[model samples]
Target: MSRLPLAALVAAFFVGLAWFVSARQALLLLVGVGLGSVLASTRFSFTTGWRRLILSRDPRSVIAQLTLLAAAAAISMPLLARFPTELNAALGPPSISLLVGAFVFGLTMQIADGCGSGTLYKAGLGVPLNMTILPLFALGSFIGSAQMDWWLALGNVNPIGLVQLYGPIEAFGITCLGLIVLALAALIWSGKKTPWFDRRLLIGAIALAVLMGLNLIIAGQPWGIVYGFGLWAAKIATASGFFNPSHNWFWSQPDNSQILSQFVLLDVTSITNIGVLAGALLVSAGKPPARAPRLTPTQWAAGLVAGFVMGYSSRLAFGCNVGAVFSGISTGSLHGWIWVPMAFCGTLIGVRLRRYLNFSG
Candidate 1:
């Protein structure tokens, strides 16, 4: 696809969305494009950042991530505080499922080489492994959501909202302080040799933060990735009569049922997801195609399984790195805070698994 045609197609799609859907959805498509472009151009990957930190004691990517969290928290917390009714936070309960799920998600992401956002953007950039994982990820996400009630039943508590409990000012302060502590820990872990910052990653972080704020303002919710995947799977399953939303606890909710019946374009997350794909395609037009990793049959099987498990675990954990960690922490949800350490522990094991599988990027 040439850049000129790709750009034209994106414009046409935007116009069609505005005409057939709504203006808000159209704008969200643009935001998604910006997100995809930034992520692709900067190579800002959460999975890679953590992996780099673990294997080489590099703190640059990790530091950029912390900066992103701090910046997002700075923007999102205050807006959530003021518009409590209009906006929604990405809150998930502190539960046994959360702990187990986050850990498993972290582990699988390393083997699969992508989290939710990572998967999407990589797929957009035409990475073969991620493209293969995309459908499996959707399937696992649907299954996880279908079984959410059982997971919650195992053990959980009501979600804790720091903004609601401590006010936005205090919540933002806490968020920033925590990020600072993490940054310092990363720096210490990396020793004196590793650089503390990368200008490209810092710019990407700031861009993502601003776009996330725009997402909240227009969509009335923080940015998310997993739910959209699950929803896509649900739509297909229900249509094919392989699954019944009416029988599923998660999809049986009034709002969930409503969206299930509507066009996918009407869904905020879905439209943005489409936009992200389009944006990536647009950006990749003139650039050389990214080289796909070479994998043995066993390695390929391992990656596909990891992709499915990553999807399922993300739902169990309430979100992937993007939905659970990024959006979760930024919006003052306590589960986001809990998600980090457990996922990191999983990553510790995952990197070893990645080596054992002989998967290389």
Candidate 2:
């Protein structure tokens, strides 16, 4: 599609959202668009960044991610402290579920070659593997959500909010200190020979951090990705009589049940998810299609299975890289802090599996 038509389509959707939903929803669609555009333009992928660090001792992307975390925390912590009632942090309990889920999610994301946001934008850019994995990811997310109660039963602790425990300034300072430690570790591991910065990635991180702040302001919640996918799948399954929300602990919640009966565009995450897809499509316009990876049948099946597991694990982990790691840490949720090392450990194993599966791109 040409840029003109693509832009027109996005505008039409924006108008439709404003008319049918609310002005805020429409604005969030634009936020999602910006997210997709920045991600696609800069190739700021959480999955690849970690993978690079693990395989090549490259610190550039890891440093960029730390910068992103620092920037987002600076922007969001104060706002969260200021508007405690209006806004919600991305909080999840520290539990057995989190540890196992984050680890598996990290592992699967490496094999699948995309985390939530990475999968969305790459799918938008028309990557065949990601496009195929999207639905399976949704299916797995729904299944994981349905079984959440069982996971929680294993063992869990109350979620800790740094902003709630400490003042915003203190929380922000703590966040910065943590990020600084990680950045220094990455730099030390990679050595002085390896460059520590990528201009495009730094720019993208700053842009995403600003947009994340906007997301919290407009939606009254931090940015998220997997919930929307599970919701979509739940709606479909419920409509088809394949699943019953009332029997499911997670979906039986007042808010979750209520949204099931409403339009998807009315949902904050869904709208942004749609917007991310559209934005990526917009970026792809007037450009040559990206080359798809080649793999054997076994590799293809492995990837598809990885996508499903990644989806399932993301829910159990309380969020993927974007929702759990990015939003969690930025908003002062301690679960985000716990999620990182577990996911990184998973990635350590996953990269090996990727090589075993003979996946190359």
Candidate 3:
């Protein structure tokens, strides 16, 4: 039927998938879908006639970000203030390690032409090179996790105690429902500054908020894409002779098992990313996936290497854009704001390079 309905159906399935799996996971994937949809909105190359369909400064992205932040704080504050456990979940603020890790991630996003969510969404669009890069990203994550103890030893900065705020807000299905509306209103209002608020913008915002809510209800956390795939790849690679014995052994524990035990910790999240690629392919099949003078083998190789850096750095930083920025902001973490500006700078530099290479505006 309609594109939005299809996305909703996919989201429904994603929620079920996460529910059957684990709440913790669904939460991360929801963040992925939410942000992916908003980013999807931003990718619209507005035309003169379709100005209304285009966005005003494409502000929905910021709206989604802000809506999430406000809703998260509104809910989270009460939860932290009343219940100690909920506060505990949201308190792992970034540290020196986080800053260092995030900056490196920024650099990698620039080189790879995709961050965590960006990579999965682009791959969803059937960018063949993205498929290649996904595995490299996983390998990097495995490396990072394997050495997580070392990072912690170096004062990775774990905020163990809760910085509690106010009351006890529900953390499941109902909460997801409440925030979805807020995200939508924020998006529509945010469009005021742009060229014009269009139907796609409105429809897309609601649909996306729905997607985010589903992920939260199902996964019990935010939606995250890149980290999972990259992690999956890392487990596979370390075991495949690409790395040392110890590297593969830990990840292999769950994955290597047969019957009643499998190690697809982020399986549903990966599928969520799969849905993004499918959505983009369906939308852009009428057009080429890449610009003219498409990337050469060397550039493709560079992209893959860069993707690896993102994987490693994102894991170290505790989240990528979707997790660190989207979910972090949604949870009202201060570092989330810090991350966006840093990432935007990276994007600007990348855009400049793209202009230099492709003469694109």
lDDT (0 to 1) per candidate: 0.93, 0.93, 0.54
Candidate 1: C-alpha lDDT = 0.93
Candidate 1: residue 234 Cα off by (Å): 0.4
Candidate 2 lDDT over residue span 1-361, tens digit each: 8889999989998998899889999999999999999999899999999999888988888888998999999999999989999999999999999999999999999999999999999999989899999999999999999999999999999999999999899999999999989988888888889888799999999999999999999999999999999999999999999998998899999999998889888999998899888888988988888788777899889999999999999999999999999999999999999999999999999999999988994
Arranged by lDDT with the best first, the candidates are 2, 1, 3
Residue 312's lDDT within candidate 3 is 85
Give the true-structure RMSD of model 3.
Answer: 7.8
Flag the better candidate by lDDT, 2 or 3.
2
Among residues 3 or more apart in sequence or in different chains, the pairs in candidate 2 whose N, CA or C atoms overlap within 3 Å are none
The estimated TM-scores of all candidates read 0.99, 0.99, 0.64
Candidate 3 achieves a global lDDT of 0.54
Task: Please report, as a residue range, the 10-residue window in candidate 1 with the lowest summed lDDT.
Answer: 274-283
Among these predicted structures, which one has the highest lDDT?
A: 2
Itemize residue pairs with steric clashes in candidate 1: none
**Full-model lDDT, candidate 2:** 0.93
Residue 72, model 3: lDDT of 50
In Å, residue 297's CA in model 1 sits off its true spot by 0.6
